[model samples]
Target: MKNLYFLALLIGFNLSAQELPNLNLLNLEGKSVSLKNDFMEKDKIYVFSFWATWCGPCINELEEMNELQEEWKKEINIEIIAVSIDDSRTQKRVKPLVKGKEWNYNVLLDTNQDFKRAMSIVNPPYTIVVKNGKIVHIQNGYVPGNEKDLYEKIKTL
Candidate 1:
């Protein structure tokens, strides 16, 4: 019975393994990048945080995640990526804001909304946690205390 259950679990995981699109985005220095190839690492828990400059919840979530950077790295092999979905209007402020806050994680540009659309994200403050090249968890909206839940999920990985 145990062997049958384990075999079923393996088959389920194999069938549900779908990767994000190999789309090109930009880094803070304005260089084109591939999200899967460049940012992702093998056997790591990486968080893709979709945010914008003007969003209050988004800012709060990112700042909270930034605070957890050092500890998360020390404990688990995790990386948090801040992907901005700001358009041309507010895109210029992204750099100054990030520099001002002194965020510790890598920032990526999705001004054209290409990456966001590809991922089917419809809102800000959404998070995707990937482990071993597979997306294990995703949160659509964030509340003030959502970081704790995210941490717990990563711990389970």
Candidate 2:
């Protein structure tokens, strides 16, 4: 019975993890944006990158993506949304960091972490690739050149 229960739970988690949590997050401009509704462009790929201001690897991932975004877009119908997981105290740093770096990403602020909790994301630099309102790929952590792998995956979708 215990083994069966565990299997059931595992299956349930797996299923939920594949779908984007229907939640609204605030963008850097302080506008509420629905992850599912607002971003649901038919046949277009959406890359949601979760990052925090303090995380070094997260910064690296976003910077790399920002640099490659234009070139990637020419080849794929893709959009990159950087979701900042910074809480109230650190939230102040988000805009300046993005502006200073001059990143072209659509930056969203997950101040209360509602979106993060709903998506079961545990760390920064966690990326999700979605299409037609469904999550098609996930990269849990970032290493140098991981963006290249992510770009390849997006091309396949």
RMSD in Å for all candidates: 4.8, 3.0
Model 2: per-residue lDDT, tens digit, 11-62? Answer: 7677535777788888888889988788999999999999999999999999
- What does the lDDT read for residue 111 in candidate 1? 95
Q: Please tell me which predicted candidate would have the highest lDDT against the true structure.
A: 2
| TM-scores for every candidate against the unseen true structure | 0.87, 0.89
lDDT for model 2, please.
Answer: 0.90
> Which 10-residue window of candidate 1 scores lowest in summed lDDT?
12-21
Candidate 1 C-alpha lDDT tens digits along 86-134: 9989999999999999998789989999978877889898888877667
- Candidate 1 ranges with C-alpha deviation above 4 Å: 1-16
